[model samples]
Target: MSSIKSPRQIAESLTELWSPRVVAEVDDAYIKVAKVQGSLAWHSHEGEDELFFILKGRLRIEMDDGAVELGEGEMFVVPKGVRHNPVAESECQLMLIERKTTQHTGNVVTEKTRSLSDQLRPV
Candidate 1:
């Protein structure tokens, strides 16, 4: 099953804030999109690097040392073992690229956390 896919369009179809939906896979990585607002718990993936690509709106990734702000058409990568929290003052659409074995929310678990199975659900 292969076809043209729009990350933005798939991101727009997402309704659950912070719940990322898996859209595709490339080797050991999973490409996911999420519609989010507010903040996700501070966490770190010990063995995986996380990539965030903004599709719409703005995002600020708060880290222990500092924070980075990203707007539409921007992207950032949180290296493995760096604690960070993603915050969006308003609704935001973004895509994520992470290892298939990466845990959602990493070492921290919260109500907003979505498991791999949940993320794999169709949009």
Candidate 2:
């Protein structure tokens, strides 16, 4: 059966900052949503590209080469092997599209890093 999922409602329902919950899956990728603020640790996916879609507020993706700022309804894709850090001065909501094998924090693990099991939970 098919169901409807609202990214806005799911994103707004999130209680933990930086913790993304798996909302849906599209073949090899998982579509996720999270409410975030502040800066997440720098990390890079070795073999997968990650996509970020800003749902609310603004986001600044700090890259080694340059930084990209995204406002509401904007989206960006961070290519594989590119080191990047996501930052939001204020609370922000976003949708993330990543391969099932893509690690949440990539090679670097911090206190904020969330596991696949953790992400595959109900919001």
Candidate 3:
């Protein structure tokens, strides 16, 4: 079993975008904390869904269909194989929930995909 997590505390420790720090994990899923700004690449998980919960600022999810804006205390789920890009106009803190094996950049394996093994840490 794992311990409880305090995302606020975990988020406080993060200082950059695309650099997520694991705050907790359950089974094959991981809860990560990140600070973000600017635009992220368009990508999609092959077989897993990803959830984004905004804790401190605004986040925008851009999809081929449309754009979804999330504010503090808001969240949205990006379903499997659905291409989307996340963007933030200002610094924001958020939690990302997805399978541990899920690629950070989904189908787009660019330099931006921070190696999952390198950024994960036990809560």
Candidate 4:
């Protein structure tokens, strides 16, 4: 049987910035946690929507349409095909819900990008 998981605890245990670790799964989506600072590339998933829930610090998601700021306990969802960049002025911990096939950086690959195999690593 599967055990219960603590998203915040798992997120806090991560040592790598911008690298996400899978925490759980629900149907077609994977629940993940990440420790981030600075910025992730501007990109969009052609077929998957990405949801972000703040667990610790602040984050600003910049998009062509506008930008949204999220604080601890807040959340946001970036629709599929919408280009967005997630930035954090200081270290922030967050939970992410995304389709299993969602690309880490969408269509843009950079040094910070992590493949599905990498994200699937044990937390």
lDDT value, residue 85 of candidate 3: 95
Weakest 10 consecutive residues of candidate 2 by summed lDDT: 1-10
- Worst 10 contiguous positions by lDDT, candidate 1: 8-17
Select the stronger candidate by lDDT from 2 and 4. Answer: 2
Instruction: List the global CA lDDT of all models.
Output: 0.96, 0.97, 0.86, 0.96
Question: What lDDT tens digits, residue by residue, belong to model 3 across residues 1-123?
Answer: 556668977886776676888877778898888888888799999899999999899999999999999999999999999999999999889999989888888879776678887677443
Q: Name model 2 segments beyond 4 Å from true.
A: none
Query: Among all windows of ten consecutive residues in candidate 4, which has the lowest summed lDDT?
Result: 4-13
Model 3 misplaced stretches (Cα beyond 4 Å) = 1-4, 121-123
TM-score of predicted structure 3: 0.91
- Error of model 4, residue 68, in angstroms: 0.2
- Model 1 CA lDDT for position 11: 88
lDDT of 2 by residue, 1-123 (tens): 769989988999999999999999999999999999999999999999999999999999999999999999999999999999999999999999999999999999999999999999877
In the predicted model 2, the residue pairs found to clash are none
lDDT string, candidate 4, 1-123, tens digits: 999888999999999999999999999999999999999999999999999999999999999999999999999999999999999999999999999999999999999999999999887
- Which ranking of candidates, highest TM-score first? 2, 1, 4, 3
